[model samples]
Target: MREDFLLLNPGPVPLAREVRTAMSEPMVSHRSAEFESVYERAQNSLDYIFERSSLDGTKTTSGGTSLVFNGTATMAMEAAVANLAGEGDEVVTVVNGKFGRRFKRIADRYANVTPVEFDWGHPVEPEAVAEAVSDDTKVVTMVHNETSTGLLNPVAEVGEIAEEHDAYFVVDGVTSLGGDEFLVDEWNVDVAVTDAQKCLAAPPGTSAMYATPRAQEAFDGEKAPFYEDLDWHLRKAESHQTPFTSAVPLFRGLAVAVENIEEEGMQERISRHRSQSRAFRAAFMAMGLSMFPEKNDESEYSNTLTAISLPAGVRENPDAFFDAVTDRSVSISGGQAHLGGEIFRVSNMGNLSSEQILRGVRAIGEAFHEAGEDVDLEAGMAAAREQLR
Candidate 1:
């Protein structure tokens, strides 16, 4: 723990030194008023981050209040889904990546879930979303940025279409939000979900959603079982409390992370991500590797994760490739199931910079070299550094 490890994986990435220090802090009693103040400040600070871009929801809840922390982002997704869709109402689920498919699976467990799936590496078409909606449709769920493929579904367009159909629009912004632009209000997004892990640069365990008054009103119509109930969270959150104890260290880390993001300035932060991403892509291309996403649709590109397609006839070996990078003391991820072995997804968003990007490119070259492939790693490194410039 004395020396920092570079995290180029999709998540739980290398945090800023400050974040590590925050996480190093000792625990405080969850019930204490001082704890509530920390919780309250955290909530308010995040509201400023997610909602500040628009004139909407700025109330922050700390101590796992503004955000539902101490759990994976899955908890936020399930809570939002279970509360909004009800037992019998219908919803549209767009699946392109592993996470998207996972969301569909979560929905299938519920009563009236209709999945609108697209081919892997393909974006969800607006028409497909339109076709999936039915008279019974109560909600529309889609992943804003498909981390598995680095292809973004047009959540803004999808949001408009869903709203036009009078359906509640719920989006999973897990890997996209902080690194790029998102519209929770103008897009008329009733439910917006994201975790602090990826683009947020905060530690894991803190996940949150933006629930509009309309979304809240709909949830008010029925009683949710136990902790799945947003009403319970609302009731307790209004009083600055959570139904259970939370990860105090994680919250402290997030508080600092959010401040760091603000200090960097959102646009500049996004630009930095774009710069590193561009450089990373250039380096890959120099090595004859291509991204799963196409160029024209780069607007739909994800800033957090880049899914690189395997080189032709190379016979994909994600494990081998990832191991190459890890051998260099940094970590990059392989694709999840279905995409596994076919694509190597590298993370860019976070506290990472051009220096890490340089190191990462060199690692990939080392891997190619070990594989006995004739690769110009120097060229890849040069291209990457140039793009960063």
Candidate 2:
């Protein structure tokens, strides 16, 4: 409750005071031993948050490694495809939301991409993905959390299908990792990418990827140009260094963010997110606001964020709703692409508290009223409280 500003967006989430303080610490040379110590600590923390014992991508071992890139998660997504897909390699990409479409778009640039598309709010069916993957398919890409619509895709099932077809499974876990439940190796995912922002509650401009030995095999073929090359990353990772000048301050912030997560415990962190999401959804539903995502069950719903259809009156004057919310010192997100003005997203990611969510819901309810909508704020608050209780 900073009172000055509150972020409810999926990315660039509200950082903890400690994480922000870590970023303010004096910068160190990327090649210095001090930086190496920081790098080693970060890697160890990331492995724990990623639930991997090791970095080599094996689920059974505790010594797996993850690549920390000084860029957005989108860069990690691109790197995953660039290293795993090449000329004549068929890539089966699941497209159910904005991020999913992004994976397809990225894959299309380097491989024969077969996109299994769904509506913006609909979940990607694993059965359809199974049908899309062929013997010639070299990679399968998916977004674990469809952030745009707050829908969770069946990544575990799709991973099984990809493994059955002997294809490398790459996941865009930008918004899901650290906040949601994800098992990289158990799900047979060959590569999974996530950023320092979003669920990690750290500053942006830094991303990480967990790649297995099998996924690394794709680098044998035509590799991406120097910057996107995973081979160079792996070679440099041995010494806790990056091939290029690393974002030292970002590393410090991310390491502290991961430390905060460790202090809270992953299961407890995930549970908090789930409870807040459920409370928000329940409150909104009680206020007669429908969810934008077309989920068949709770499992298909995202715990990091919740997307709600725009109120009828607000849809006609969406800016009023957004502006009203912002005026209340709470910053949320609007729908993207074709869904713009049709829905609004509220994130409960990072270190948000029950009081914060309660206040956010009330503010949005007030915004609904400001937009000339008939919403029962009392009912919504009551419902949210019940869920939180």
lDDT of 1 by residue, 1-389 (tens): 42656788788777888988988877888777866776677677666566643222232221222455557778788777888776687989998878888778777666488888888778778898888886578888888888878887788777888887899888898887677666676676887788888888888888877677788878742544466678877777675667778677887788788778777766676677888887887888888787876667567677667778766443445566667777778777776777667667788877787888898888878886765556778888889989888
* lDDT values, one for every candidate: 0.75, 0.85
- Model 2: CA > 4 A from native: 1-3, 52-63, 294-296
TM-scores of all candidate predictions against the true structure? 0.92, 0.95
Q: For this target, which candidate reaches the highest TM-score against the unseen true structure?
A: 2
RMSD of each: 3.3, 2.8
Total backbone clashes of model 1? Answer: 7
